[model samples]
Target: MFSYSILLIAALCGAATSDPSTSTDLLWPLPNGNTVGSDMYSLDSKTFMFVPAGKGGSSDVLKEALERYMKLIFLPSPVPALASSITAPMDKLTVTVDSSDETLALNTDNSYMLDTSMSMLSAKTVYGALKGLETFSQLVSTNSMGQFQVPSFKANDVPSFLYRGFMIDTSRHFLEMKTIMDHLDAMAYSKFNVLHWHIVDDQSFPYTSIAFPAMSVKGAYDQNHIYSQDDIAQVIKYAKYRGIRVVVEFDTPGHTQSWGKGIPNLLTPCYANDKPTGTYGPINPTLDSTWTFLHTFFTEIARVFPDSYIHLGGDEVSFLCWESNPDIQKWMKMMNYTNYAQLEQYYETKLLELVKTIGKQYVVWQEIFDNKLEVLPDTVIHVWKGGDNWPKEVYNITKAGLKTLLSSCWYLNYISYGEDWPKYYQCDPLAFNGTAEQQALVVGGEACIWAEYVDSTNFLPRTWPRAGAIAERLWSKTDFSDLHSATTRLHNHRCRLIVRGIPAQPPSGPSFCPHEWEE
Candidate 1:
């Protein structure tokens, strides 16, 4: 059953072996522990085995993951290597996974060990098995031998952080479902576990809300440009098998122009000399209906998105809108709320309390604490502003005994003419000055692509390899800041991404990915 290509590879200069696309010794995100041997295994003879662990094992999940990888690891053939004889294909590789029942989550165990010597993959849960499978796929390459092969190797790998996150703002511009799924596939390959879906904003509300079904019809760019309820469920299901947690972010109060379109009066009316100015700003905090709508709205949100934590966006609320509104001022004066800061605090306090009552933890932008709001101790602060001042913010947030995550340096939307990723790749999530306890309060960080100028057409290339840099920082033990061997590995990983169907852009100047990225 050998194909013509396989025969051509076999017939290439007698006794010649093929060189790998790159040094196979270099692994992306550098494993915590690993060693490669001179020996190789023929992937052409690859077979699978699952030792059924009775308690939490899902044989179907393991089998499906392996089956999916069957095509992913079939690498394109390369040139000759070592001028040697063809290596005989090995027998079945008994891949045994344990505790496969653990659903992917923030705290799911994802450590795994893969050893080709015994032809074994050792993982606790399906999440861990998925991670192992990605690594194994990276190991497969070609040679003059008539088969695809992976060198003998053993790797015991563990991620340094629990929340290796990637975010896409679909509201700024609509991205097709297939595009999001492609990014998810690449995320899974890079060991990223969280999808911070910023699903709605001022420009659009593309998420179809079941509780408020008319929201998309009223707020989305068009009837055809929205993600239906079924679309979301399919996204969640697709992510689940690949071990990614989907966290939908319905950013509120400020980035909510689209929300008021579906439900008018949700936003405060701007005023000039106490006359309606035909403009709106943040959500109207003084309205009882506002609170009531939010209660019902988030009640549905809590049910729909099963993530333990939800992003309650408390960012960029303009005080000018409230300042110009006399009724809000009147409400503030009656409550002795001398300032808009107090008004914001009052609104957030209600929202946070309701979210707590609904049985979910919450993440908010750093502005909540910066505004001196007395938030609950369990709140996770997302530090995204301050630019170079990010370290100070991270230090201050952790110093205040609140857990924090940094996204300041990882915004992938800001681009330059050449190689902008090194800046992002070098920015360490833990680069701030802090003590052991203060530093320990840092859980993880996210790389976000806000999508103002991004969409399905250019999303994959712009995001891929660059976001992979952030993933490495989150997962690896060291930052790899020196970029000695790291650059070569990154270049190779970019090619791997392209070969595996991510279509990632080249990492740096003058590189190849088996072939140039075709449009």
Candidate 2:
């Protein structure tokens, strides 16, 4: 449990707030977007006639449907003045979408144009556009009359990185589907395009593998926390409806303690004082059954997660078991492998190849580079070690022509409010110590929330606003790095988040009870 003093300090130090409402709003769509075409309006009583252009029949349909629903609901309310006043406030807000071919006309007091030529009828594409619209609306604010308005701005914007992501570590402490979906809603709100689900780890295996029922059934927090096949499909469907890609990371070889403890035969054992230990150690890299199990696991995961990338965690393996086993050592010597590193490489490379056969891109931690494993085709490396200097190790991997993801600047769990987030926003993934060609291999990175001491009570507030900062870093232009301006905007954003039901950690400093805002 976080003390009030600690929360206060974090809020003041990090420029965050204690309100979960703000945190929830950090990801939901602004009221204006839904209300503009509907009965609900901004506080200013501004009205709009949103005339969407050719092929914009769908928007027109949604607008009419929403308006009708609003009228129906408001008709019964005794305080018609409240609904009427609310509808009048949105009068000035209007959007005339030109579908003559494909274009979005944002004629706010400020004019903005978006190239929607690629827009399609497919649910995924529509959901993606809606998700973008939600984030775009979050960036807008209201005038004195409570009319939502965007700054006079115009830019043809597209995401620099294809995979703007957040990885929630569920293995440490399981979060319910409602909580997970809430996080997903938050991700969509922040314009985070990818959800890297860390489904398995050393602590537990929360993924339900139908092909191998023994995996999650034996490893989860009882059976309820296990994510069954149906649950996985529902999550994917919901995420797709919001234009989010769900990527699954099943950590292997090293973080397999839960799996090994459950199915002892599937694990490579360690020898403690000359006795074979049942716990997971360096996996039997050359074992035939190991390959078979991994193959089945990947196949099952591939069927579930639609995203093309699969994270095969190749980080942190102890070599005590390999060093002690005489048979393994004899085999290693016979294969001309002089050290344990080579054995690890053998495991990584072969497993990657196996995953490739199943048609999935691979992502690994920087430890893969440290271990000097043979490079897999189209691999992405997530660099976690944070500091002022980019490591020579990361450069070596990118220099060798592999794409990299920069997590060094994006660990949300570092627990700073805005201090660390702006740094993450300022550090360009393409501005590394390698050649432009090598740097071009930078894909993207995520604000990783390692759920060590977090659960439903604290996770949302801890992650938001800061995660929003990182999201803008990944999605918007780098020039949005002004700390002072961001702080003021963030202050309002905190209030907005509160209204939206986000439990974002309040910005620290002096405590002002929210009720006092009116005073």
The lDDT for every candidate, in the order shown, is: 0.79, 0.59
Model 1, stretches more than 4 Å misplaced?
Answer: 1-26, 45-56, 77-88, 516-519
Report the error of model 2 at residue 340, Å. Answer: 1.3
Q: Candidate 1 lDDT, tens digit per residue, 1-519?
A: 121112122222232112442234336766668776666656553453334343444566676777787777765632322222334454555565767465666779888898877778777777887888888777776655546666677889998888889889999899999998999999988889999889999999998887787789899999889998788888887887788888888777899999989997899899888798899999999998998899898888888788888999899889898999989988998999988999999989999999999998989999998888889999999999999999999999999999998899999999888777778778877778899999888888999999989999999999978888888888878744656456656766777776667889866766445544544
> lDDT winner among the candidates?
1
Whose TM-score is greatest here? 1
Name the TM-score of candidate 2.
0.76
Superposing every Cα of model 1 onto the true structure, what RMSD results? Answer: 5.0
lDDT computed for candidate 2: 0.59
